[model samples]
Target: MIHQIRIDNFKSLVDFEIGLSRFSCLVGLNGAGKSTVLQALDFISQQMRGDIDSWLEQRQWEPRDLGSKLTAKQNVDISVQVETEKHGLIEWSASFNRQSLRCTTEEAFCDGVRLLKVEDAEFWIDRSVKQGSLRDVRSEIMFEYQGSILSQLKRKQIGEPLQALKEVLANIRSLDLLSPEHLRQRTRDSAGHLGLGGQKLSAYLHEQGSEVRQRLLEKLQHAYPQLASIDTRSLRSGWKHLDIAEQFSGKVLSTPARHVNDGLLRLLAVLSQLASDEHFLLFDEIENGINPELVEFLVDALVESEHQVMVTTHSPVILNYLEDEVAKQGVIYLYKNAKGATQSIRLFEIPSLAEKLQFMGPGEAFIDTQLTELATEIQSLSAKGGKDVSAAKR
Candidate 1:
């Protein structure tokens, strides 16, 4: 599970850092860098998966597009801290050259001991005696590697700590901006994971066991009383499709994927993600196409999920459903500073909001406040020695 992230020179996130909980909700206005945070995480996941060039090509982004325009830095840095059962707390960082779109340096540290380091195209793997022991450099120099050094190494060569770190990074799944049209398409029979846009949901649903399918049905029924059942069918062309059955007045109605409502399809995508095998999940605008009454179910399911999840939303109803304890730690507010750099602070850390939280729910306070105006007030109060601004600045 990722406990924290540090992104430097990536879009508007210059020297930015945010701590994460098992479940987090990122709330902010549009263009406030909420989506950019997910993009940064996605970029790191892509780098760890192998070829960075293919990811760039898929997005039609230039190598220089990775860096922020606010800084003249030639390199972009992305780092994450993950807590693993076997390795404890492991911190991994990768530096990429903006012009080449390749990893220039990468390093890992577990509980303060350096386990892996790669610099100047020369890499070293430490086969230390124990988990927190001193670094033992098993050095090697490779000049012709692409993407990340960790991705290029064989599992046989790396120690347990490095192997665990790679696995955690490679397993990140971003389900951002899911489209209903994409979700309705038939996919190959071998598709096991929901495609980033939920395009392969039919094939992935076909592979689930009966227990998991039953759990999904229960979840859907709670929000959608008409939903009777959901199943998959095979196409003659070796593709798979989804069929949903809804009951009304004791009459069963069968519908194909192409005919399902937008809300139902989006809800299915959201619930199916909670049952996925990915260790970390990123969801953007989760409230989109979901009814206000069902927002509670979505928030509750996400909180109870075992996987580490990060969600972004502009809906006040979503915030209203969070429990007080969870809202205190898991709710993050993102805003752009006067310099146009993205800044993040926990929701409770804001002096203006903290005062109101005592008297109201997060959603009530959020709906009643204007963030940019509150930012200006905080700045004025800081100048007058009224409150410590540093707490909210970070």
Candidate 2:
């Protein structure tokens, strides 16, 4: 699991680092850079899977503004430190110049010690040994950077440590709130792991066994009481159509999946993700189109999956449900500093959190912290003018 993450000179996340829990939530007002963090993580993962250029094109990010516009920095840095019960601790990081996104420096470490460092075109791998130790790996390998060294090593099985880091980085999955219409379509691509936008849900559902399918249907029923049944029909055209029944209809009437409520459709997409085998999950704008009443069920869905999950939300109802599942430390509050940089504070890390939680629910506590005064607006530095800006009263 990823124990922590550090992102520098990437969009709004300039020199940002945060500790992670098995389950965590990013709480912030609009434009607080929560999505920026998720994007940075996604960018790095995509770089490992493919290359920087392809990832940028896939995301449709304007290359001119991909790097931190807040500074003249020529490169961006993204890193994650992960620890497993068996493999211990490892850190993987990459630095690529913004202009060409060509690799500048890429490095990995084991237990806080550097294991490999890659510069412009040169690669270095350390195989250090303790004197007279039978487990000596003092030999090292050096290669010119054609692409990511970690990716190269994994493809070649050159080193166990590099392979571990490559595997972890390649496994990162970030699921943004899915598009309803996109979810309704017959998926053109069938991915074992769900895509960043939660497409191919139809294919995913059709591929699951009876037990998992029943569980997914039950989750849908919990969110949409009227949802009686869901099944996929393979047409003569060899395409799949997701069909559903209403609770009152008792399987007599079936509704095409496209007709499902927007909120219900999003919930279905989320449930599909929860049912997956991925070890780590990141979701952006998770509250979009979800029923406020079903917030608790959503919490249960995430918790029951037992994956290392992170989501960003502005919903207090969601927070109230999360309060019971995650400790105070599991909540990270993202706010904008005067410099317009993103800043974070764990709710539990605050000494006075108990006093606030005692008087009100977690949702209310979050609102209380965000308030300057009843009449005054939440403030931030204006990125355009570098002046103080006010947000309307919550």
Candidate 3:
């Protein structure tokens, strides 16, 4: 699990640091930098994959473009400090200039030595000009820009870094911003590979016997009573599909991935990801398109599951269900200041607030206490006249 993240010079995040919990919910209005935080994680993953250049290119800017705009330097530099449960602390930084595309200036520290450095080819340039009576150096270094660190290291028989990168990527999964078609394709694909987003859910089910399938169905039903039973099968020509039988109805309904509603598909996607051995799950707008009553069940499921889940939501129903868990410091609320910088406040840390009151759930207590109009009015009056003004006047 990542205990904390410190971001600097990243897009829309000048300097942001937020402590994370095992199961956290980032709540605020839109453009509050929620998606940007997720994007930072994605940026790290892409960098580890050795697709940093391509990633920047996809952003439609060169290092100089970003650096010139943000830092007023010829090169753009960004750093991410990640504190992990297993790795302790790992700091990764990348810098890019117009002359040099992108360079990995830093990586995981092991035994006082950096594990990796920017390959010369990554900063490939055509020619080097001299200022005075010196000869120009035109030689440059460049590596294959297509493959990730894993692919590059595998070719060189370097396995440790690849394994580490893979582990980190596995721990970070983003299901937000997924298109409808992407969701459907992932559902269909998960039936076979369940890699991520249920990419191979089908293959895993096929490998399991009837007993395993039955046990899984029982567990799913326990988590969601609306689900009667789930059946999966492969077509005669080898296409896999899922059939969901609704409770109280004997009729079995079958449909391809495209026909399922967004809520059900999102649930399945989340469940599939949670079923893995990965420790951390990051969910953006988790309450989107889901039934309100089911939100509690989802929260309860995540709490009971072995993995540590971090979800962002605006639903009061979900917040209410999580109040108890949050009182134990399991929940965090992310908000933006006047300048639009992200800040976090723990619900449990509210002064003069008892655990019992806090556990009454976020809907009636925290949200009402902090965001209600009455509370705001009280605060305004207190600020103007002080707390003793009412008693003294009376």
Residues 1-394, candidate 3: write the lDDT tens digits. 5555555555555555666666767665566567666766655455445555665665565544433223434533455444445445544455533354434343433233344444444321111111221113222334444323333444233234324534665356555454445455523323222432344445455554456666666756755666666567776656556655665566655555567677776676566566655656767778876788678777877766777677777666776786465644654545544454554545444343344363465655655554323223434545776641111111
Q: Which tens-of-lDDT digit does each residue in 316-379 have in candidate 2?
A: 7777776533747577767766577776657544445546777677777766674322112223
Q: 354 in model 2: Cα distance from truth in Å? A: 4.3
**lDDT against true structure, model 1:** 0.81
Global lDDT scores for all candidate models: 0.81, 0.67, 0.52
Give me the runs in candidate 1 sitting further than 4 Å from their true place: 129-146, 189-191, 209-211, 378-394
My TM-score estimates for the predictions, one after another, are 0.92, 0.83, 0.68
Candidate 3 Cα deviation (angstroms), residue 94: 4.0
Arrange candidates, best TM-score first: 1, 2, 3
Candidate 2 — what's its lDDT? Answer: 0.67
lDDT (Cα, tens digit) per residue for candidate 1, span 1-394: 8888888999999988888888888987788899998888888887777777776785678787888999989888888888999879998888888766678888888878888778765677775526454334546564455567777777777778888888888888888858898889898753467866788889888888557777898989999988888888788887987999999999999999998988899889889988888888899999988888888988999989998888999988988998777888888888787888887778776777888899999899889888767657656756898744534233
